[model samples]
Target: MRNVILYVNLTLDGHLAGPAGELDWMLFDPEMNIALSGEMRSRVDTILTGRAFHHGIEENFRAQASDPASPAELVDFATWMISTPQVVFSRSLAEVAAPHRLAGEDLAAEVAALKALPGKDMVLFGGVSIVQQFVRAGLVDEYWIKLYPTAIGAGQPLFTEQRTRLELVDSKAWASGILTLRYRPAR
Candidate 1:
């Protein structure tokens, strides 16, 4: 079965977004982009996200993939992002365009079905509630968290709905102080 990887960026205080769900404070690094792209290329075949994050992710990457002015590394990453299949967990959306689809109402069941399919691991690029739901359901197999040095005092947190014990598997720190930590549920 494929693993469900929760890949996200968090502030120093562990929030995923600012108080208003804004992401302007998150630091962006070109080197991190290359590393992330390489990881995705090798391990991820599907993209999963909640409705709130789907539009921005799609729009940003689509534009980057097509824009001639985008950096080579970003363009490559954007191309991979757009080409990967995305499953959005949403109830109100009637339908999504090509390369994107709405997951069934049964979140756990839908994820189970996806995992049973033959493919590389799946990445959950979340917006708060979706991450909460998956964590509460105990469905995530791995966590890839990029912790930025910045701190937004109050914001949408990544683990507000669940308490999990994780074992760190690997970690890397960049010169910019962006730290990437990989963890798995403690056995």
Candidate 2:
């Protein structure tokens, strides 16, 4: 079975986004980009994300893949983002474009079915509510959090109401002050 990894970027204060859903505070450099791409390439084959992020960030990444002016490394990363299959969970969205499918009602069941399929692994990129659902359901197999140096005091918190104990599996510190922490649900 494939693993479901929650890969996200968080502020030092644990906010996924700013008060107004702004992600401008998250730092991204060439090294960080390369590191992220390497991890994604090695671990994930499918991406699970909320509809909001699919429409907002994912679309932008897809566009960046085809842009001639985009940096080479970013373009390569965008290619990976666009090529990977994605399942977008949304109650209101009826349809989505190619490379992405609108998931059914039962999130856990759908995730389970996906895990049963032959694949490298799946990753869930957060938009708050979806991450909360997965956390509450205890569906996530691993957590890959990239912690930024800045703090957004008033914003969407990553943990929310769910409380799950995680055992640290690995950690890496980047020169850009972004810390990558990998964890798994405590057995």
TM-score of each prediction: 0.95, 0.93
Check candidate 2 and list the clashing pairs. Answer: none
- Residue 68 lDDT in model 1? 95
- Tens digits of lDDT, candidate 1, 1-187: 9999998889999898988888887777878868876976799999999987888788898899999999888898888887888999998899999878999999989999999999999999888889989988899999999999999899988886457899999999998899999999999
Say which candidate scores most in lDDT.
Answer: 1
Candidate 2 local lDDT, 71-174, one digit each (tens): 98889878887778889999989898887798889987898889889979898986888987898899999999999999877898888776779999999899
Candidate 2 TM-score, true structure as reference: 0.93
Off by over 4 Å in 1: none
lDDT of model 1, residue 150: 93
Candidate 2: stretches off by over 4 Å: none
Q: How many pairs of residues collide in each model?
A: 0, 0
User: What is the model-wide C-alpha lDDT for candidate 2?
Assistant: 0.86
